[model samples]
Structures are given as structure tokens and as C-alpha cells.
Target: MSVDVEGKSLVDLLDMLEPAPVPEPISMVPQTWGWSVLALILAGLIILGVYAFLRHRQFNAYRREALIELAASDNNAAKVAEILRRTALVAYPRRKVAALHGKEWTNFLNQTSDNVTFTDGAGRQLVEAPYRDVKADPDLEILARNWIKSHKRERTA
Candidate 1:
């Protein structure tokens, strides 16, 4: 069991042993780009959503101002009528709203906003309320504000 190896050279001993196998170099991370592409797409969608929200707020900026003015005004009837007229003028042509009188004006208001009937409901007060000493319907104020906030503009040629 005790063999002598004093005469053997280091190269002969190394040549006698088997060589260690060389491993192929490998990358730890996968090569797929789907995750980065998905992240970029998600970021783009969020940016587009925020931009759409800001644009919508800008488009309805006038409604917010009118509501605030309506809330702060002392003369409810005159202010309500004025706000409606001004809003109509902005939405429609001047000729359409300029000469409307009494019931016709109320009817126009109702047509513009299908949610409330201005002619038959509390909005009828707007006809004579501005000219004479008349008490404005408290409900009309709420209805008008809601209409102004939610009314969709009609396209006129």
C-alpha cells in the first residue's frame, strides 16, 4: 500500500490525473423584453389618463365659475336668468338667445338641458322674476346648477 513516488515529476503526476471539465459561461438574467415593454405601456396609459382629466376640467372651467357666482349672488332670479342666458349664448349663436322672451326662453332652457323642464317646473319664475318683485324658487337654483354642470352642448351650424 505504500508506493514510492519520489522519482516522479510534477508534470507526470498532473498528466496522470483527469482534467477538470470547462463550463460554458451563462447569463443570470433572461433575455426577454416583454416586462420592460409592458412597464412602458402602463406608464403611457397613466400619462394619457391624467392629460384627459386635465383637458376635461379645462373644458368645463366656465361651469364652475358660473356655479360659484350663482351661489354667491343676492338677486337669485336675475342672477339665475343672467347665468342661463350667458351660458346659452356661449353654447349657441347670439341670434338664437338674444330675442327669446318669457315662456320661449324657459322652453329653450329646458331644451338645452333635458334633465329638467324649465318651463313647467320651478324655472317658470325666471320669466317674470327678473322684471317684477317675485320670489325665486329655491329648487330652481339647484336644478339650474345641476343642469349647468351636466348639460351637453349641441352642435350648431
Candidate 2:
């Protein structure tokens, strides 16, 4: 029998197989529209999450600010009175404590200051001034101011 000349056998040459070719990636964007719908759903969820977070933060911040103001303030009751007045201002934008006079003003004031007695005449109007008017009683102003410290209601506290 004749021997192989170089070295490796014919068996080694036949044992090796060719490597498989890599497949190209298919483009889903051009083929199907489902990806766009999924993207829109994700975007909507993101927007909703952001809006909720912002609103919660705003509410917390408002509560914190109110607490800080109350802590620093010497008068708590009067602060509550002012807060109520501000609420009323938002509720009824047309007639404010300053612009309103007579029975209308008294009725508005009565809601906040429950203890004070009022007459049909200039009773309510007398105490309607923001900065102590001649007709408005100074003692009543002091009473309202004192009440501010007592009436302040905080969410956190």
C-alpha cells in the first residue's frame, strides 16, 4: 500500500463542514403598522404619568407653603379668616370685601365671622373695610385678626 505524502489523512478533509450563512434582519416598520400603535400607547401612558406626578407635587407644595406661613405667623385665627375670605373671592369674583357694601358685604362677612351681631342698616358695611375704615369698627377688626390665628386649617397638620 502507498502512504500519504504530506501528513493529514483523507478522513480529516471530509470531516469539516461549511459554516452556515447569517440571515439578514427583516424590517418590521415597512411590513407592519402594529409598532406605531404600540408606540402611541406608550406615549399616552407616559403623558398621563407625568401629569399625575405634577398635580400631586403642586398640591403637596401648596400644603407645605401654608404650613410654613402658619408656623411663622403669630396670629393663627386671623390667618384662617383671611384664607376663608380668599376662598370667597375665588367663589365670587365680581364683588370683593372692599368693593361690596351694605347688606351684601355683611352677609359675606357673616359667613366667616359667626360671633359678631349685625343690624339691617350699616352694621355689616361698617366692618367691611380691609384697612380700617371710619365706619368699620376697630375692635371688630382686632377680633377678626385674633381669629385668624385660631381658624387656620392645614392638611398636613
Top TM-score hit: 1
Local distance difference test values of all predictions, in order: 0.79, 0.50
Over 5-113, each residue of candidate 2 has an lDDT whose tens digit, in order, gives: 4666677655554578989987667455787888899999999999999987764453445445544534433443344355435334443454765566556555555
Candidate 2 segments whose C-alpha is farther than 4 A from its true place: 1-15, 26-30, 41-68, 91-157
lDDT of 1 at 106: 83
Q: Highest lDDT: give the candidate number.
A: 1
Q: Report clash pairs, candidate 1.
A: none
Give TM per candidate.
Answer: 0.71, 0.35
lDDT of 1 by residue, 20-43 (tens): 998988976546898778878999
Q: What is the C-alpha RMSD of each candidate to the true structure, in Å?
A: 8.6, 11.8
lDDT for 91 in candidate 1 is: 69
lDDT of candidate 2? 0.50
